[model samples]
Structure formats: C-alpha cells, structure tokens
Target: MAQETAQQAPTTAHTAPARALLPLILPAALVGVVASLVFVGVSTAAEQLQHVLWGPLPDALGVGRYSVLWMFVMLVATGFAVGLVVWKVPGHAGPDPATLGLDARTMPPVVLPGLVLATGLMLAGGPSLGPENPIIAVNVALAVWLGRRFLPRTPGALWPVLAEAATIGALFGTPLAAALVVSEALAGRPMRGRLWDNVFAPLTAGAFGAMTTTLVFHPTFDLGLPTLGHPHWQDLVAALVIASASAVLGMCAVYAFPYIHKAFLGLRHPMLMLPAGGLVLGALAALGGHLTLFKGLSEVGVLARDPEGWSAGQFATMAVVKLAALLVAASCGFRGGRIFPSVFVGTALGLCAHALVPAVQPALGVATGVLGILLAITRQGWVSLFTAAVLVASPAVLALLCIASLPAWLLVTGRPQMQLRDDGTPIR
Candidate 1:
C-alpha cells in the first residue's frame, strides 16, 4: 500500500505541470484565432472599400481606373479624412504609426476601435503602409482585456507575447515566422525553465493563428520563378553586391527617417500635418503611378510577375518613389506598418539589379535585396533573413541568402532604426 501510494503521488506530480500549462496554452490559442479573425475582417473591409473607391466609383463616373489625377485626389482626400479622425477621435487613434513599431505599448480597449478605423482608412484609400502594427496593437489590447476578464490567473507579460506571436503568424501565414521572430526577440532575456518552455504558449498561439488565417485568406507571395537548380559562384558574388548596395541605399532612408519625422511633428496639428502629408503623397503617386501606391505587399507581386517588362530606369524610379512614399506615410502620422513598404522598395531595387545585369537570377537578386533593406529598416537580422527567403518561396536559396546576410548585417548594424521615441515623440 505504501509503494502504491508513492507511485500515485509521482503520477500526480508528473501531471501537475501539464495541468498548469493548460490555462496558458488554451487562452493563447483562443487569442490567436480571435486575432486572426479580426485581421481578416479588417483587411477584407479595407479591400472592399478600395474596390469601391478605386474601382467601381471611377468606372461609374466614366473615368479611367488608372487615372493619375483621380488617384491624387483620392489620396489627398484619404489623408484629410484620416487626419480628421485623429483630431477628433476619442483616443486620438491610439498614437502616430510613424512613431510605433512591432513593439509598441499596449493600448486600452477604448482606443482599439479608433485605431482600427484609422488603419482601415489608411489602407483603403492609399498609403505606403501595411496592416501589421495597428492590427497587432488591436490584438494586444483585445487579448489583455479578455485575459483580465476570463483568465485572471494568467501572467500579464505572456499576453503581449501571445498577441505578438499570433498576429505575426496570421500576417505571414506560418507559425515558423512567429517562432523565429519570437526566438530572436527573447534570446537574451532571462527566463526560468527551458527556452522552449518560454516559447510554448506563444508558438501554440501562432500555430492556431496561422492555420486560421490560411483557411480564410489563402494568401500567397510566390513569384513563380523557375526552379533554381543550384547556387552558382557567380550567384553568391552577385547576391553580396546586390544586398550590399541595397543596404547602403536603405541607410540613406534610415538617416532621413528621423529628420522627416521631426519635421512633420513640428507642424503639431493633424489638420496641418496629415493633409500636407496627403498632398505630398498625392504628388508622389502622380509621379510614381499606381504601382507605387498602397502598403506595397500586392505591388511586390505585380513587380515580380513582369520584371522583364519594365526598363531599368522605370524600376529605379519606382524604387525611389516607393521609398519616398514610405517616408511620407510614416512621418505624416499615417496608421500603418513599415515592413510591407520596405519589402516593396527592396523588390524594386532588386528588379533594377536584374535588369542591369541579366546574369543575376531574379530570385537571388530579390532575396538579397529584401534581406539588406529589411535589415537596414528593422534592424532585425532573423526577421530580415526570413522575409527575404520567404519572399522567394524557395528554400534552396536560403544557404546563399545566409551568406549574403552577413554583409547586409554589417551595413545595417548600429544604424538608426525606424522606431519612435518612448515619450510619444519622434526618435531623433
């Protein structure tokens, strides 16, 4: 009887950790799914609005769908509209996006709706931004609110981790993306238990989020390049050169980011700053054409599909225009993220490289370009590497990309990053 009781005690002890982890895993998984749904809903609404304004409305009015004049007018109108919301909204739309990044402070539940509305407007009308930061902020706020309401015993810090992981998973349509990003983020932090233990709840949340997003959206970023047979010596050299050049180019923007942000802040009023920003964006759009507008995710596809069709001059112009648009959108209090626009800029630059030198593989050129630009912009090596490799949709080139990333990292390390100041001001 003594031996049997001892065995039973050990069995119960073994089960205790799993039982305790249930609360963490379950709530995080729930947050992941809910966050994915929220993102899908928000993006869908923006798409519909975009179709109405840029598609049906123009057709109904007997104007060309790609009319540059109309595009300028619409963008200016979008800027004014978003500015008005920021001026009068209950939460001031939860902070300027140019001053925010993936690691922003969690906002209150009351502010979530305002942020969502501003993001939708920015996305739907026209802005060189993506849904990443605002949507992540929304999920973080929602997750925290839900946790307080239902899982009072849960750790507070875990909420942001799970929220970030879930949203990243949803955004990229893969749990691996979130895992890599989280691992990189949490690598140096002191923690108890195994590293995987820290990652368990967040990875679980990310898996659910990715799966849910895939089911609903079925998004793809494949450029449909012919299968890369093997990495050639020339490919390595070319990738290094391309990535290094792109990094150098990106640094120019990084240096300019703070100054532009400060200039916009000097205006000190949404009425003045946002609308003026809108007009600047309008002029850029008129100059760069339709492909240079928007948050730039879909534009990458458009560029990739027909790289050969465009001349080197055209590609260079697009790259420059997109970079400028990203700067304006970010500095002008736009509600969006930097990743997608940065990716677009990189793609344009890569296409230019390929056009100038046909010997370079499109996949290789694009991957390295993206790697360099993302590194320079975000200052995160793993995220930059992952984004570059994933954009190519070819795992075979990852080894070459790893090699290319070394030079790229060297260029971007210690450079000014695209994050805002802690006191709700521009980082100078």
Candidate 2:
C-alpha cells in the first residue's frame, strides 16, 4: 500500500504541475505580446532605414535605385558601418554570428543596441541574410533581463524558452511553426512531466506572439501559387528528385562555408573583410541581378509572379549567385541569418527544374526545392517542412513535402553543416 500510494503521489503531483502551468498562461501571453512587438519594432526600423538609403537618398542623388554602381556604393558603405559597430561596440556585437543559431542565448542587455545596429545595417545593405538570429537573440536577452527583474519566482530557464517560442512565432506569423520547432527542441531534453505539459506555457507564448504579429503586421507566407489538386505518382518522384538535388546544392555551400570563412579570416579584420565581401557581392549582383539581393522573400515573390520572364539559364544563375552571396555575407563578419536567402536559392533552383522539364508543375518544384535546401541549411526538419508547405498552402503540397523531406533529410544528415564554432570547427 505504501509503494502504491507513493506512486500515486507523483501522478497527482503531475496534475498539480499542469494546473500550476495554467496560471502561467497569463504571463506567457504577456511575454509573447511584448516579444512580438519587439520583433515588429526592430523590423519596422530596419525597413524605414532601408527606404531612406535605397529610395529617397538614391533618388535624390540621381542614381538608379538598383544600378550596379549604387549597389557597390551602398554595399561598401553598409559594410564599413556595420564593421565599425562590431569592432567598437561592447561584446563585439555578441560573438561571430556564424557561431549562433535559432536557439537564443541570454546576453547582457548592453549588447542589444549594438546587435540591433549591426542587424539593421545588414538588412538595409543588401546582404543575403535574414533578421532571425539577432532578432531572436535580442528578444531572448530582453525577456531574461526583464523576467529576472520583475518575476523573480519564475524558474530561471523558462524565460529563454518563452522568448524564443514567441519570437519564432512572430517570425513565421503562425504559432504552429513555433510550437512544432519548440516541441522538437524540448523533446531532446530531460523532462519532469509529460511533453505536452512542459510545452504548455511556451505554446501559449507562441500563440499570443503569432496573434500579435498577425494583428499588427499582417504578414503572409502564402505565395498565392496556383492551387495544387490531387497529386500523381510522378509528383512524388518530382518532389523526391528536386528535394534531393536541392539538398545536394545546399551541401555544396556547406562544404564551401569554412573555406570561405578561412579566406575572410586571412583579411584579419572586420573592416577589411566586410568591405572586400561587399565588392565581391557587387560583382555577383551584376551577374545575379537585383532580385538576388536582400533577404529573398519579396524577391522570391517577384520571381514567382512572373515565372515566364526568366529562362532556365537565368534561374540557375540566380540560384548559384544568391547561394554565393549568402555564403559571402555569412562568411564575412555579417550579422544575419541564412534561412531566408537559402529559400530564395531553393526557389530559383526549383523554377529552373520546372523550366527544364515543363511537365514538372511549377508550384510543386518550388515547394520541394525550398524543403530540400532548408533541410540542409537549417537542419530543422519540421520548420523546414512548414516553411515549404506554407509557400504553396496546399494540403496536397504538405503531403508531398512530408515524403520529399525524407530523401533530402538523409542527404543533409551527417553532412558538415554551414555553421562553424568560434574556433572555426564545424559545430557537428
């Protein structure tokens, strides 16, 4: 009876934790809302700055908005400015960005400003990187500092999870992606309760964060591709082939990453490395065209909107060029994320497939391409699958993506990932 009672105690206590977590819903929601607002705030500031630099200033100077010379000038100037921030700012903008990932680390609050500055400059300066890494770091740091000051009773570890989930939720404009990603991450850790129980607060935070971003920003991942109906057996084959091929391409970039970084390291300083990278990027821009610039989201839309405008050769060039640009930007002391640009590379590659084999559906090619490349680049399977499917927004495509991800995942698995440690070794 004693043994049975003791076992029963834990079962009952488990229920208590679940109930205790219910109260956390309020705090979770609050944190989610605030974190999302921070995302919005930072993104808005960057867009405004980008407009000033590329729009009015260029127009006032009588230079074409996307002319090669202007691109060279802006890219060089942005490199120098960001280099100054990294060199002069405390904490060196919180370590080499190549050493970071989607998982957030709490940093001293003072590092946030410099981090934001570098991130903003990179965003506006035509780097083939996204805002995910720094933005997540910023949100996590803020949540940790504020949570410790205001709610001392909360477990010290929860703040990072809450903030990370919230920021990811805000980033994708959907709680589903955040919940899926956080669940994958948490599943690997030792836990005291049911997986769902541990996830409760973080899920709430993701929900509120996604909701806040949706209400405020109205962002959409759906590319409005033509509705995909029932899939054929050939569709499965196409998905597999395209995804596998895209993963192989991403692996090429992964292989080249360390060498690229090593080359930049020879330049020996941020000032020299970034400016040199900017010049190379300008040359790539000339070849890849302006659409290969920036984070690749809107540019991808433009590509999709007018698929007939580009030939297969042009599509292939854009993919290779964008991939190279991403490698350069990430390798050369830039502060940003690679996911968005990788999506563009995948998009172009997928379209190239469609152009080469007219029987391959354009929409399916694009989705599978994104799935494959993201699988390699991020190694976050669920989020990669989600991002790919969301682009097409078809239940049919999701079915295909699930099958597509398998081969792609195998190809990327155990390969050298694109990221490197501070000491320059692969993190794997």
Candidate 3:
C-alpha cells in the first residue's frame, strides 16, 4: 500500500497541469466572448460616428467628403471633446495614451467610460492611431471587475493575461498573434510551474476572441501585389538594406518620442495641449493629403494596391506625414495605439523602396520594412515578425523575413522604447 501511494503521487503531479486546463475552460471562454463583444461594440459605435462625421454631416454642410477644411475643423472639435472628457470624467481616460500599451498597469472599472469616449472621438476624428491600447485597457478593467464577482477563486493577474489575449487576438484576427506577443513578453521571466500551464488559458481565450471578431466585422486586407512564389538570394540583400534603413528611421522616432511627449505635457492642460496638437496634425494632414490621415489601416491597403503608381517622392511624403501624425496623436492627448500607424509607415517605406529600385519584390520589401519598424517600436521580435509576415500575406517570404529580423533586432535591442514615465516624463 505504501508503494502504491508513492506511484500515485508522481502520477498526480504529472497530470496536474492538464487537469488545471479543464476547470479554466469556461472562464477563459467567457473572458474571450465578453472581451470581444466589448471591442466590437466600441468599434461599431466609432465607425458609425465616423460615417456621420465624415459623411452625412459634411453633406449637410454642402462640403465634399473628407474636405480639407471640414477635416481640419472636425479634428479640432474632436480634440476639445476628448479633452473635456479627460478633464471632467471620472477616470481621466485611464492614463495618458502616450505612455501605455497592452502590458501597462491595470486600471479600474471607473476608467472605462472615459477611455471609450476618448477612443471613439479619436477614431472618429481620424487620428493616426488605432483603438488597440484604449480598448485593451477597457476590457482588462472589465474582466477584472467581472472576475471578482463571478470568479472569486481566480488569481487577479490571470484576468489581465486573459484580457490581453482576447483583445490582441480580436485586433489581429488571430490567436497566434496573441500567443506570439504574450510569449515574447513572458519568455525571460522567472518560471514557477509548467509553461503550458500559463499559456493554455490565454490561448483558449484568444482563439475564441479571434473567431468572434472575424464573424462580426470581417476586416479586410488586400495588398494587390503579385504572389511571391519563392525567395531568391538577392531578396535577402534587399531585405537587409530596406530593413536596416527602416530601423534607423524607427530609432529616430523612438528617441524623439519622449521629448515630444514632454513638450505636449508641458502645456499643463488638456484644454490647451490637445487642441494645439490637433491643429498641428490638421496642418500635416492637409500637407500630405487625405491618404495620410486616419489610423492607416484602410490607407495601407490603398498604398499597397498600387505600389508602382506613386512616385518615390510621393511615397516619401506619405511616410513622413504619417510618422508625424503618429507622434502628434500620441503626445498631444489623443487616445490610441502606435502599432497600426507604424505598419502604415513601414508599408510606405517598402513601396518607396520598390519604386526607387524596381528590382525588389513588393512583398519582400514591405514585409522587411514592417518587421524592422515594428521591432524598433514595440521591441518585441516575435510580434514584429508575425505582424510583418501577416501584413504581406505571403508565406514564401517568411524565411527571409525571419533572417531580416535578426539584424533589425540587433539594432533596436538596447534602445529606449516608446513608452513614457508614470509622471508624464519620458523614460530615458
């Protein structure tokens, strides 16, 4: 009997992690569904607002769609509206968006309304940022609040992980993306139990979140580039050059991010800072034309569909203008995330490279450009690599992109990230 007891103890130890997954399944699925629903609801509201603000309202005013003057006025108005919320609302829109991301400190439920309003206003007003950061914050806070009421035994930290997984999966339209981003985050941290134990719940949540978003919105991605059948040795060289140059450009922005945030914060009031920032962004949008406005998702498709149609100079102008928009929106009190804008800038850089050289394939150029820029901006190799691969939608170039990332990663590893200090100061 004593011998049997010893054997049973080892068996139980071996199966503990697997058994843990079974009980977590329901909670994980619920988190995924709830998180995705919140994201969809907010995004839908923003899209409707966008259509009205940029469409029917303009028609009522007898102006053309996205007219420069209307856009300028609307953007300024958005700034004031969001600033009012930040100044008057319960949570001050959670935190300054310039200093936040998926992995930031978790906020309370009281912050949700402010975050939603700020995100909606910024999205509707055509800020060069995405709903990622603000949306994630909202979902995370909601998940924690719900978990406390319904899942009394669950760890508080697990809710953040689940919320991040669900939101990232929904945003990227893939569970793999959430996995890559989270694993990259957890890679070097101290390990206490089996790694799969930590990964199982998040993966389950992310998968459901991705499926829910896909069924609801069906976001589009069409590059119109020729299929990349196979990679050549020359492709490697081109990728290296393009990616390196993009890394340098991204580093310039990264180093400058803190100073820009400080300057805007120095305004000392959202009332003053955001409207002024909006004016600057409006001027830039006017200079770069309509294509450089917005979060750059649909605009990226526009750029990718006709890489050869634009002159090198045109592409350069778009990249520069979008980069400036990203800086301003982040620093100037607008609520949004940096990833989408960085992707747009990267795509423009790749298109510019193809325009200049004509020898590099558009897919190779775009993928490598995105990889370098995202790596520098996020400082996460797995997320950057996955995003670049997914953007071009070409599996053939994956190997070359993987190789290209190494050099880019080396360039950005020790650099300052785009996040800010808690006191609104730049982290050096």
Candidate 4:
C-alpha cells in the first residue's frame, strides 16, 4: 500500500498552466534550502579539518604552520589521501575532476560518499582548487537520488537544473549568478515555455539557496577598494589594457592545460601523479609564498586588504604561481574546481596592474583583470561580469567591464577551453 502510494506522488511535474509557474514552486524552494544545508555541512567539516592540519598539528611539531617545508609535507600527504580515495573508492571519485566544470553531471548514490570525501579532503588539504565543482556534483547527485525516492512524480529532468541552480546560488551567495548561468544554459535548446517561465523554478530555487547560505555564512564579495563615483575615459583605456592582457595570459594557461593533464595522466596511477603534482605545487608555494597555497578566497581578501604592500613584481609572481598551481591541481587527480583559484590569479594580476600604473583606480584594475581572466578560463561571460563586478562592488565598474570584455572575449572565443576534450564530449 505504502509502496504503491509512494511510487505515485504528484502528477509528473510536466504540465503547467500556460501563464503561471505554480507546480514547481514548493519543491524547488525546499530543494534549494536543503542544498545549501548540505553545502554548509561539508564546508564546515572541511574548515575544521583544515584548521587542525594547518594549525595545531604544526605548532605541536614546532614547525611553522603553512611554512615552505610544512606546505610540502601537508600537500604531499593530502595528495596521498585523495589518491587513495580515488583509487579505492567506488566510481573513482566520480571521474577525473580535471574534466569537469559547472556542467558536472549527476552520479550514482554509491559514488556520492567517495566524492564527498575526496572533495572535502581537497578543500582541507590546500589543493589550489575550490568547492564549486564538486559541491555542485554532490548536490545534484543527492537531489536526484532523494528526489526520485520521495517526489517520484516530478519530471526526471528538472532535478538537475534545480540542483545546479541551488548550488550555484549557495556557493556565490546570490541567486542572480544562478539565474544568469541557467539562462545561458537554457538558450539554444528547444523548450516548451517562455524564457522567464522556464527560468521560474530555477530562480525560486536559487533565491532560497542564496537566502539560506547567506543567513548561515554571512558571505560578501566586495573588496572595500575606494569607490569610483563615475567612470573616467582613462578608466576605459586602463580597463581595456588590463582586461586584454589578462585574457591573453589566461589563454596561455588554457593552451598549456592539455599538455599538463597529459603529462600527469602519463604517470598512469593516481598515487604517483598526485604526489608529483604536490611536489611541484610545493615549489610554487615557496616562490609565491603562503598566499598561493589554498583555494584562495581568504587569501584574496588579504591581498585586497594590503594591496600596496607587495611590489609589482611580487604580485606578478604570485599571479603566475597561483595560475600554475591551479593548473597542476586540476590536472593531477585532485577533486575540486578551478574558478576560485582562477579568480585569485586574476586578482593578483589586477593588483599588479595597479602597482605598475598608480593612475588606474584599484577597483577598475582588479575588476577588469578578473573579467578578462574569467572570460578566458570559464568562457562564461555572465559569470565573468558578475564575479568581477562583485569584487569592485561598484555599478560604474560594469560599464568598464562591458567595454573591456569585448576585447577579452575576442582573444578567448576561438581558443581551446581550459578542460581537455574526450571524443568531442567533455570528459565525465
């Protein structure tokens, strides 16, 4: 009796009123809140472990926390741990993280445990990657698994969209980013409804997701740079130069990605490849200092706080090292995403631009710099715009970014994406 009733819930969430989006509202909002809860749980656990690994453990041993030598030790150890999970766990931690992006697909319920373990370790272990990719994967997997078990009548396809939107909203602390990304994904696909109607469910999920995450985390993206009241003609010129150059630099990384991934994969085992990548990352951390070590959100904050402290050369080196580390981390079997570390690279380069040309407003420098690098790497124009604008927290920066993004987009449009391809499909 319960089994039959459970098997049949609401009507297959397929039919909707032509004018109103009502059926998806409650389920999607609930999914969004629950997704944010999952994110907060995983991140909190990772942070606790991170503190232990980088703090008391080092102090007890009388070594400098996050020191050059300690970084080498911890990073190698972390690689070993993640490698073990990838090798021994089911689904091999749900595909090589190097091959994934915002479009990471859902996985089996069996794969979720190992995926969470691997991603959590990557986050705590200081692999220059972020939680965005794997968290999305995790949420999507869970949403599908649980949604089917409970809400069997919901259309199968809607689960992925709701999950992805919710995760993006939770990760960025704003539903707007999710809305833009979903809009981009929706375009060019044959669909039944109007754009706004189609987006209605995702927007609801994103709103709830963002709201829950913000209530829990109090996250903010602004950098506290001196605000620009109005855009200057020179600001446009400076933004153009910075954005274009940053895009080229990002392209260089994109070009190098396949070679790097091939080199690491050539090792033929997660154990050997990941540890070797760790050694290289240790060397990079030494050159770029501790700020280049982690996924880079807090480190970026530090950089923004003391923008004038580092020399231009120093900032440039940090940018290069972080970019290199991002490449290595992504290529070598680590379970994480590239966006946060890429943002750090852009931030450092933007600061370098400001250091070189004091005439450029620091906000404009960083915003355009981010715009260019994000465009080159993510190939998501709306993400590049949203993330960069959030950095400056200025409406005026948007105009400059709009102009600067034109050239940056041109440089990156025909280039290879940062991920390697597999038989025309993105590797899963």
Candidate 5:
C-alpha cells in the first residue's frame, strides 16, 4: 500500500504540469489566431490607404507649397500619438520597431494597443515604419493577456515564449523564422529538457496564425523569383563588396537611429516639435521633388520598376535626402517603423552602385544592394534576401545578393546595442 501510494503521488505530480499546459496552450493558440487576423486587417488597410493617398496628396500639396506644411503636420501627428502612448500605455509604447532582434520575452503587454494604433497611423500618415513589428507586438501582448486570463495558475514563462513565437511566425509568414526568434529570446535561460515541449505549443500556434494570415490577406510584395541570366564571378565579387558596404551602413543606422529618436523625445513641447519635424520633412521632400513625403515603398517600387528613370547623381541625391528626412522625422518624435525608410535607403544605394559600376547589371546591382542593406540594418538576412530576389524576379541576382551581404553583416555587427529609457537610463 505504501509503494502504491508513492506511485500515485508521482503520477499526480506529473499529470499536473501536463494539465496546466493544456489550458495555456489552447487559449494561446486562439489568441494567436485572432492577433494574426487583426494584423492582416491592419496591414491591408494601411496598404490601401497608401495607394489612395500617394498620388492625390502629392498633387494637392503642390510640391513646394506642401513640403513645409506636411512636415509640421507629421510632427504634430506623431507627437499626439506618442503622447497617447505615454499617457495610456503601460510600457511607454511597444517594442522599438527598428531594433527588433528576437527579444520578445522581455516585452511588456500594456503598450501593445498604443503601439498598434500608432503604427497604423504612421503607416497611413506616410511615415516610413513597417507594419510587421507592430503586428508582432500586439499579437504577443494579446496572447499573454489571454493566457493569463485563462490559465491563472500556469507558469508565467510559458505564455510569453509561446505568444512571441506565434506572433513572430504569423508576422514573418514563416515558421522557421518565428522559431528562431523564440530561440534567440529564450537564449541564456535554463529550460532544461522542457524547452522543446514548450516550443511545441507555440510552434503549433504560430502555424495556425500564419495560415490565418495567408487566408485572410495576400502579401503586399510577391515573395518569388524567376530564372535570370547567370551571375559572373565579377558580379559575385561586386555583390560581396556591396553587401559589406551595406552592412557598415546598416550598423551606422542602428547606432544612430536611437540618438535620432532621443532628439525627438527631448523636445519638451509637442506643439513645437511636431511643427519643426514637419517643416524639416517638407524641406527634405522638396529635394526629392515630392518623392520623399510618403512611406517610400512607392518610390522604391518606381525605382525598381524603372531603374533608368533617375540618373546616378539623382539616385545618390535622393538617397541622401530620404535618409536625412527619415532621420529628422524620426528624431522629431514621428511615430512609425524604420523598415520602409531603410528600404528606401537601400534602393537608392543600389541605384547609386549600378551607376558607379556599369559592369554590373543594373537590376542585379539594385537588387543585391537592397538585400544587403536589409540584411545589415534589419538583421533579417533571409527575409531581406527573399524580398530583393522577389522584387526583381531573378534567382541569379539573389545568389549574388547573398554573397554580397556578408561584408555588410560583418561591419554592422554589435552596433545596435544602444538602449535608452524615456528618462534616459541607457538600458543596453
């Protein structure tokens, strides 16, 4: 009877953990699905707005007349958004959309909604931020809330890990990336043999979320490549060189971006800061002849679609102007993701490279350069490469891009470690 009772005790203890996980897992998955759907809806809305507003706004703004006013408007809008976030949200806002690198576990939940709303505004209002990071942030927050509500007795760690993975997977449209992000976030933590089991629920949840995203909305960019001309050894070398250069630039961006953000934060009054940022943005927009006003995806598309429209000098000028505008807007407390601006910079750099190295195929050079910048700045190597390849419809170019991105990656390594609190604590 003693031995039987002992065995029963062990069984009871073992069953408890499994049973505890059940409630968390199921609710987490449902939350993930809902979050993904929300992301799809938001992304779709943003894209449609971009299309509708792009042409009309520019024409109405009348290039020179609107530039200053637009800048001021952007600043005011951004300040308002930031104020809302700071006042209402718990974590002061969501994740830094620019410095994202699989660190979701440490994220706070209260800032999710504000981040989402702010990001949507940024995107629709013509800021350079992307929708992906905000989407992931909201999803993770929602998952945590759902898990806590449903499984109050479960371990806290499980929900975050699962939620982050699911959200990342759904955002990236790839389970592999999501899994990798989760692994990175959980790095240094001691999970024992339970790590794999814990991830299982998240991975399943992520898969469900991704499927829902796919069914509800189509990706804005085509993620495919077609056969293209063979890449030469010289092309490969050029790509490598370009990739290295991009990485270096990326490192600079990562390090400088925070400071830029800080400058905007330092502004005591939103009324002054918003108008100032908008004015600067407008002046910069004038340099690009109105091309620099919006989120820059359309501008990138224009360059990609017609590589010859702008001369080398024009491309270089535009790239510099866009970068300056992005810096100013971001620094002035403009709410948005940095992804589109980075892409704009990459595209301009690629165009410049094509002009400098006439031996390289223009399309290939542009594609490679863009990919390299994406890899370096975002640290999302595969996604960047895929985006570049798909935009050009060329596998050979992608191969070259992959080779070139190495140096950029090497140069930019360890540059984005800077972290600052609202009161300037310098956390990282």
Candidate 6:
C-alpha cells in the first residue's frame, strides 16, 4: 500500500505541471483572440454605421436650417432609443457614466450586449456619445465571457485581468495606454502578481485590435501639422492660465452632471423629457448657429484647420452654448459619452484664449485646455496630454501642455466632490 501511494503521488505531481501549463497558455491565448475580435468588430461596425446614418440624415432633412419639425423628430428618435435601453437591457443598460472612475478592471459580460446596442442606437439616432468607451466595455465583457466559458477551471484572477487589459489595449488605440490603465485599475487589488502574467495578453490583443481597426475604420491620427507647434513664451504663460481655468470648469461640469441626470430621471416619461431636451438643445445649437450640435468634433476640426475665420467672440459663444447644450443633452437622458463634448469645449476655450492674447499660439492653447479638462474629468493626465498634443500637431505644445496640466491635476484632486460608487451610483 505504501509503494502504491508513493507511485500515485509522483504521477499526480507530473500531471499537475502539464495541467498548469495548459491553463496558462491556452486561456491567455483565447482571451487575446476573443478580445481582439471584439475590438475590431465593434470598432468597424460603429464607424460604418455612423457614416451611413449621418450622411443621409442631414441631406434628407434638407440643406437649409434645422427646422423645428426635424428637431422634434430627432428628439423622439433619441428618446425612443433611451427608453428602450432603460426598459429592456439588464443592469439598466450598462454602467452609468457619472459613476465611472479610473478603474477599468473586470466588468460583467452583460456590459457587452448592452454597450453594443446602446452605442449603436445613440450613433444612429444622433445622440453625441463617442464609440470609444462602449468599445472598451464590449471588448472587456467579451474577454470576461470568453474566459468564463473556455477556462472555467482556471484561476479566476488570471483570466479577468488578462481579458480586461487586452480589451483596453484594443479600445485605446495605444496598447501602452491600455496596459497602464488596466494596471492602475488593479493597483489596490490583491491580484497584483497574477496581473503581471496577464500583461502579455493585453499587448497581443491590443496589437491585433489596432491592426484590425486601422484596416476597417481607417482612423486618422494626423491633425495636419508638422509636429506639435512650439510654444512662445507668451503662449506658455497663456497655456498655464487656460489650463487652470479649464480645470475649474471641468470640475464644475463633472460635479453637475450627476445632478442634471437625476433631474431628467425625475421627468417621469421619456417621450416628454426627450423632446424637451431636444428642443433645448436645438435652441442652444441655434444660439451658436448650428456649430454646437451633432457631436462638435467636426466643428472643432473646422476651427483648428481654419483658425483665421473665427473671432474670439464666436469661439467664446460656441464654448458657452456647447457646454450648456451638452449639459442639457446628458441631463435629459441622451445616450452618449462626454469625451468628445469635453474635447470640443476645451478647443473652443483654447481658441477664446488665443483670441484674447494674439501673441499666444492657438495650438498651444488648445493643447493646454484639452489636457486640463481631461485631467479634471477623466483623471487621465497622460492620455489627455497625448490627445492634446496630437490634436494641435505640435510636439512642443504637447510638452508645454503636459507641464501645464500638473497644476490642473492638483486642482482636480483637491476637489472634495465624489463622482461614482462601485455599484454604479452617481453622487453629485
């Protein structure tokens, strides 16, 4: 009996090594492939849908002004989408934006279908949320789902971290940023060691996702400048001032968002509330002469590409009206993310700064304002800085923007307001 037992022990130990190796390699590889597929599929689908919808909708509405009837039609369409999400999907149609923080660890599989449907509806109906956040959610959810189905016996900690990181990598367009965000999300958790093993998965997933996205969507990274422009001494000083101001404004927006959303929730009916919000948005858009509506990035591009055409007053008006419209749209239950609106707002603020100080470069001010807002709202200083730098087509501006964002970060961190709770509650 003793010899038999000893023989069984060695056999068991030998099998354990093979089993362990299988779990590590197979599950990790599966996660990478699944996450990459989710990223590519969702990213391609969203962009194609956007182009198809936007092209015909505008022309069909006619070449003239956005009429009240058309505005109402859009409002009803948007409201219907929101109503479907709120009523149909589980977990109340995915994570509440007001409550999301820097944490991007493992989210549930439910987030995948919810995000895809919600994002598709919003984009189709012309609500202003960007596809990037939903893409992240979908990819992460897919990874988690794949991990669960294929590697159920594997250590739970290993698969989730790897899958999430890979999903982030695919969504962010930069694997390094995806890895950093995922690592940061895991910072306080007990699974730090396992997280190290998962790093390679995300990197691979991100590379695959990026390649697929580039092929399908053909996203443009170049903003048409020869390196981020250098900042003059005056431009540097102005950037500091603009960034500081943007930090304060961003905090205000963040704090107010939840309250606004809550207020809309109290309206009791999507049909009524949605049209009301649309009317308000339409009015605001008219106030800004149509430049403030329909996702402001194109307008921002126009401003950036041709700064000479817009005066300081126009920029300031556009900034104020766009901010107000965004607040109303979000508060009234429009399905969208705040990133693009924030970027548009930041660019307008930058243009306003340049108008006030002609000696300061417009590109530098744009970078500074964008970085400041991103720091205050997203708490993602590095990503914001990179975005600002890229948008301005100036490496020197990027450097200065990074430097200026420190004080902006300080201001944001010092605020006592709470943004979100773990269970997806938004605290105003």
lDDT of all predictions: 0.86, 0.89, 0.85, 0.89, 0.62, 0.64
Ranking by TM-score: 2, 3, 4, 1, 6, 5
Consecutive 10-residue window with the lowest summed lDDT within model 3: 10-19
Per-residue alpha-carbon lDDT of model 2 for 198-265, expressed as tens digits? 77888899999999999999989887778777999999999999999999999898899899999998
**lDDT of candidate 1 over 63-133, digit per residue (tens):** 88778878878888898898888999899899777667787578988888888999999999988999999
Q: Give the clash count for model 6.
A: 8
Comparing 2 with 6 on lDDT, the higher-scoring candidate is 2
Residue 71 local lDDT, model 5? 51
Q: What does the lDDT come to for candidate 1? A: 0.86
Model 1 bad stretches (over 4 Å): 1-17, 422-428
Predicted structure 4: clash tally: 0
Candidate 2's displacement at residue 144, Å, is: 0.8
Model 3 per-residue lDDT tens digits across residues 223-294: 667767777888889999899888888888888888888898899999988888888888988888888888
Clashing pairs in 4: none
TM value for model 1: 0.94
- lDDT for residue 242 in candidate 3, whole number 0-100: 90
lDDT ranking from best to worst?
Answer: 2, 4, 1, 3, 6, 5
RMSD of each predicted structure: 5.3, 2.5, 3.7, 7.6, 6.6, 7.5
- List runs of model 4 lying over 4 Å from the truth: 1-20, 423-428
Q: Give me the displacement of residue 362 in model 2, in angstroms.
A: 1.6
The list of candidate 3 runs beyond 4 A from truth reads: 1-15, 424-428
- Return the top candidate by TM-score: 2
Error of 3 at 91 (Å): 1.0
How many residue pairs of model 3 clash at the backbone?
A: 0
